[model samples]
Target chain A: GAGVSQTPSNKVTEKGKYVELRCDPISGHTALYWYRQSLGQGPEFLIYFQGTGAADDSGLPNDRFFAVRPEGSVSTLKIQRTERGDSAVYLCASSDIAGAREQYFGPGTRLTVT
Target chain B: AQSVAQPEDQVNVAEGNPLTVKCTYSVSGNPYLFWYVQYPNRGLQFLLKYITGDNLVKGSYGFEAEFNKSQTSFHLKKPSALVSDSALYFCAVRDMLDTGNQFYFGTGTSLTVIP
Candidate 1:
């Protein structure tokens, strides 16, 4: 089966610009999550969606970051007025509702705010 | 708040020798500890998890981890190291009782299995 997949494996944009990262979760996965990874660091949770609605957005750094998982399958992470500090790898993961909490990760989209 | 820590930034071991990567976690409730390995430029791969039952849990690639409740630790161990095992490892913790389903990951530890 196809694992979680992210689009635009790499993206480079200027500071103050806007960027959107996409994620396609595995078939039958009801839960999806977004995380950010800086150099030499582990992934930090960003947002999570259960079904068609976001169950938790507390991990989002600020109002500039927002995510949506419409139809409970594909998700998009949107950054507004991106800053150089927003440069990092954006990871997407998905898991089945009935299954354990082990998440399947995607290749991730590397966002570089120049 | 829940968190995990990989105190060691890097660890080196000769092939055929034992290897251990330390991990400790802090959570308000019983933790669901997990270990993941990531190769260069690849996404993190799940190795093992300690949900309940036995404290000793076996995982993929001849790996295992010991869950110590008192010490608040769940260290990854392998009896014999392999050069291929060299990679970055991350320790994660999740609270079973947290309805929000938030998970935390450590900084990560780089393991170099010398041949």
Candidate 2:
């Protein structure tokens, strides 16, 4: 059984550029979540999806931060007008429908805005 | 609104000695408590969770946490520390009563095990 995985383990982009991070959840997982982790800090919730629709996206910082799980398996996080403050690790997690609390995390994608 | 707190910025312990990382949480409902460990250059790994039942819950890598309802605390403890145990620990809380599955995480407490 493979764990959650993210593409482009690392990404570097200039400030004001747009970047999209992808996450592949575990097979059959009905719930997915995205989090942002700044250096020396804990991961913060960004969005959550149940099935094909986002169940809770209130954690999104602003309009520039958006995410979608269209097929209900893979998710993409889009950040427009990237800022230096957005330079951090983006983590994706997935859990079974019965146990949403026991989430399995991906290795994370480190995004650096220069 | 729910929140978690890891009052200690860091905790130091010698190899073979006991260690404890304190965590407290505030919520409006029966809380779902969780502990996660993160190694450098990696993502979070779930250690243990306290949904209900036992007050003391054991987790991977010889770690355990005690959930206290009256005191609003869930302190992680280990009988003997190891150098490999050194990492960042985060305490999270979810208000199970809420319709949204939102989790609140603490700032994290770094553990340093001296060999």
Candidate 3:
């Protein structure tokens, strides 16, 4: 089976610009999550969606970060007015369900805000 | 808040020797612990998980983890080290009782297997 896939493996943009990262979860995965990983650091949670609705958005750093999982399969992480601090690897993961299932991760989209 | 900690930033072991990467977790309720390995420029790959029942859980590539409730730790261990096993390892924990059920990851430990 195909694992989670993320588009635009690398994206470079200027500060204050907008960028969108896409994720395609594994087949039949009902839960999707987004995380940010800085250099020499672990991945930090961003947002999670159960089905079409976002079950948790608390991990989102600020209002500038938003994510949507419409149609219950594909998800998009949108960053508004990106900052240099936003430069990092954006990871996407998915699980069969929300509980104790292990998440399958994608190659991730590396966003560089110069 | 749920959180996990990898006390060691790096671990080095000779090939064919045993290896251990330590991880501790804090959660309000019973924990769902997991181990993941990441190669350079690649996404995280699941190693193993401990939901309940057995304290020792085996995973891919001859990896295993022991879940300790009293110590609040889930340490990743392997019987023998291989040069191919060198990678960054992350420990994660999820509070089963939490409604959101988001995982908390550790800082990550880089493992280097010296040949």
Docking class of 2: medium
Q: In order, what lDDT does every prediction score?
A: 0.93, 0.92, 0.95
Q: Candidate 2's C-alpha lDDT?
A: 0.92
Best by TM-score: 3
How well does candidate 2 score on lDDT at residue A41? Answer: 76
Write one digit per residue (lDDT tens) for candidate 3, span A1-114.
899999999999999999999999999999999999999889999888999999999999999999998799999999999999999999999999999999999999999999
TM-score pick, better of 2 and 3: 3
Better of 2 and 3 by lDDT: 3
Tens digit of per-residue lDDT, candidate 2, span B1-115: 7999999999999999999999999999898999999888777899999999999999999999999999999999999999999999999998878777988889999999999
Q: Which stretches of candidate 2 lie over 4 Å from their true place?
A: A98-100
Model 2, residue B88: C-alpha shift (Å): 0.9
Chain A structural similarity (TM-score) per candidate? 0.96, 0.96, 0.98
The TM-scores, one per candidate, come to 0.98, 0.97, 0.98
DockQ of each: 0.68, 0.67, 0.87
Q: Better model by TM-score, 1 or 3? A: 3
Tell me the spans in candidate 1 whose CA falls farther than 4 Å from its real position: A98-100
